[model samples]
Target: MKKIFVLDTNVLLQDPNAIYAFEDNEVVIPAIVLEEIDNKKRNADELGRNARQISRMMDGLRNQGRLFEGIDLPNGGRLKVELNHRSFAKLQETFAEGTNDNRILAVALNYHMEEQENPNPRPVVMVSKDTLVRIKADVLGLTAQDYLTDRIVNMPDMYMGYLTIHAHPSVIDEFYTYRYLNVNSLHLAYPLNPHEFVILKDEMGTSKSALLKVNADGKKLEPLFLSNDPIWGIGARNAQQRMALELLLNDEIPIVTLTGKAGTGKTLLTLAAGLLKVEDERKYKKLLIARPVVPMGKDIGYLPGEKEEKLRPWMQPIYDNLEYLFDTKKAGDIEKILAGLGSIQVEALTYIRGRSIPGQFIIIDEAQNLSKHEVKTIVSRVGEGSKIVLLGDPEQIDHPYLDASSNGLTYVVERFKAQNISGHITLERGERSHLAQLAADLL
Candidate 1:
């Protein structure tokens, strides 16, 4: 049986193309959702962009027929703008508020009631990205679900970019002697992806092990390009970080993703590799660092200054890492170093849109705050001869509509894991400090 889907404002804001995702199922857009989208259509952010895009889509649909009655979608689904279900009569007793959420719930509840009156009723699902909305829907005895089109389902067991295999003791020795081993020699149960990291352990249970990477051909295991060499004075402290560096420094792999908790050295390692490639090796003409400007807690509101000064707080973390890499002795020293280098640019992700970036090493910090579309827009802006590294902890996202499973960082990690030009590593250990590591684990 065909179902009916009621979309909340956030679902459309997170993904403008969600209207077409229901797949021949009737999609209902409450009138309140249009109002909310209109309110957000003018502001300059991802939400505003999505709101405008959705408006344009609705406009295009409007030309075909009256939305209030119902319009046939290209995918054989029916789209309708519901304007009559705004009354809170059904929810006044329990909800007791005329808020937008309650209004949306009212619309879904009305559809549910109408379906019940029919001899054969279709399932009514309220799709939203908000947890409270889903809970309230359940309280109202309405079926609800998350917008899962872009969500990575098995997030807990998602790809970690590496695997451990126990082989014959001689396999480890052979890898060391030959410097490379064919995939068939491992007698593996699963196929290894290109550039996937491997830890070959001794089957006899000795302390012998070797770290290797699947070559681009995905047919051989090869030793790391930089075993112990430090990049820009920063060395990998763990096996995962070592694997990350292997991908970060490789020119053939143009996209690298690093994910970890608060202090797993994701940003530090990425910055180190970017600096080396842009400065020491001169492989790239510039080092461009950008990150979404999502606030962590209560926002500090606006500050008074020019663009650079206004962006100082948001870019301070990047500066701190650069300060460490440059070993700046005093305040403002890193800024001077950046100025003298003349090849490094640090800006918000906002300014990066619509520009074709080439011959640069780009590092997108806190990438987990970005939505799938936002990340796609930024990455698609990469021109030839450019490499983009996205680094963030999926669990530490700050975007209101994004979660660990749906955020762009995890999304890219899963989508690009099998591609030859992309590589990913999830750092498990925190190397910031003993206290930081303990705090990350315990609290």
Candidate 2:
């Protein structure tokens, strides 16, 4: 049966080509959605770019006929700008003054109810990016769905890029004794992502032991060099950890991005790699680490004391990682290291703008908090002979305008992965305490 898809403004803002995504399904653009798009089109960001793209698409369609009325889309569905629907009557009982969401709902309700009365009726599905709007659709008894095309992956299943395998007891022995196993031979359930972790279980025994990682190939993976352990003194806990270490240790791929849950070692690996490159390989002259001060916005509110003092809290985790790396036993040991090393600098991302960095090993933590535009700006600042790593999990992102799929970190990974100079790995499994892993999974 033919179906009608009513798109929300946010869906278009998130991805302008959303209209073409419905394939053969009829597309109904609520009149209010245009107004919302018009309001956001002037902004200078990804959303604005998408809005303009949508405008251009609508313009291109204008040649076929008036898009405001009805036009045939390339996907074999009719594109329409809905101006009237009888469902507005239902809104009168629920909302005295109609809000935009209510109006969009009214359009879907009108269509659904009218179709129900039709001898031959079609399905009407409301497509939106807002969770609340979808919830309201259920209350109104209309079908609702997220515009899933913009998502980086299909589901939470993308967490570690997933791979499961069973190995003879020998693989576990190789993992503990060799501390690394061949990349092949494990025969992962899923194709191995460069830094993807795997849990190798004893296929036969219920009480059999587990091997955290045995590498993707049957080659001896790099051992955890004591020098490369996170400042916290912990190493990669599983196969994914070793994979992450391999990617981090290699100097050829100048840009690497790591995305994983907290304790999956995203930050730890980046820091460890940066330290290894700077202190051991001399691949770069300095190791510079920085993170966005803003969790959601660019705002850094005024704080007491000096600039560094105000930044201390935002940079605390970075310091903690550094402290662990240095094995600072005394209370002030880390501060002293920071004073002497001078090679390592922890600062806010705000200061990074307009600075041309060269011959440095740079690690940008919490990169998911950065906007696509902001990321472009930061990456462009790199001069020749520099390696910059951007690390963060999209699911754990705090950026208001970006989701896991569209955030700067994911954006960078997708955009750069094809290039020989760049690589990406999504870490799975938490090396943190079992409780932390449980929280990541359930909560």
Q: Against the true structure, whose lDDT is highest?
A: 1
Q: Any runs in candidate 2 off by more than 4 Å, and if so which?
A: 42-44, 59-64, 84-87, 159-164, 168-243, 292-316, 323-342, 345-358, 369-385, 400-443
Q: What lDDT does the true structure give each of the candidates?
A: 0.90, 0.75
Any residue pairs clashing in model 1, and if so which? none
Candidate 2, 30-85: lDDT as tens digits: 98888888887886445667788888888888899877679988778889988766
Residue 346, candidate 2: how far off, in angstroms? 4.1
Question: Which candidate achieves the best TM-score against the true structure?
Answer: 1
Candidate 2 backbone overlaps, count = 14
Alpha carbon lDDT of residue 264, candidate 1? 96
lDDT of 2 at 325: 76
The regions of model 1 sitting more than 4 angstroms off are 295-302
Q: Positional deviation of 167 in candidate 2, in angstroms?
A: 3.7
Provide the RMSD of all predictions against the true structure, rounded to 1 decimal: 2.6, 5.1
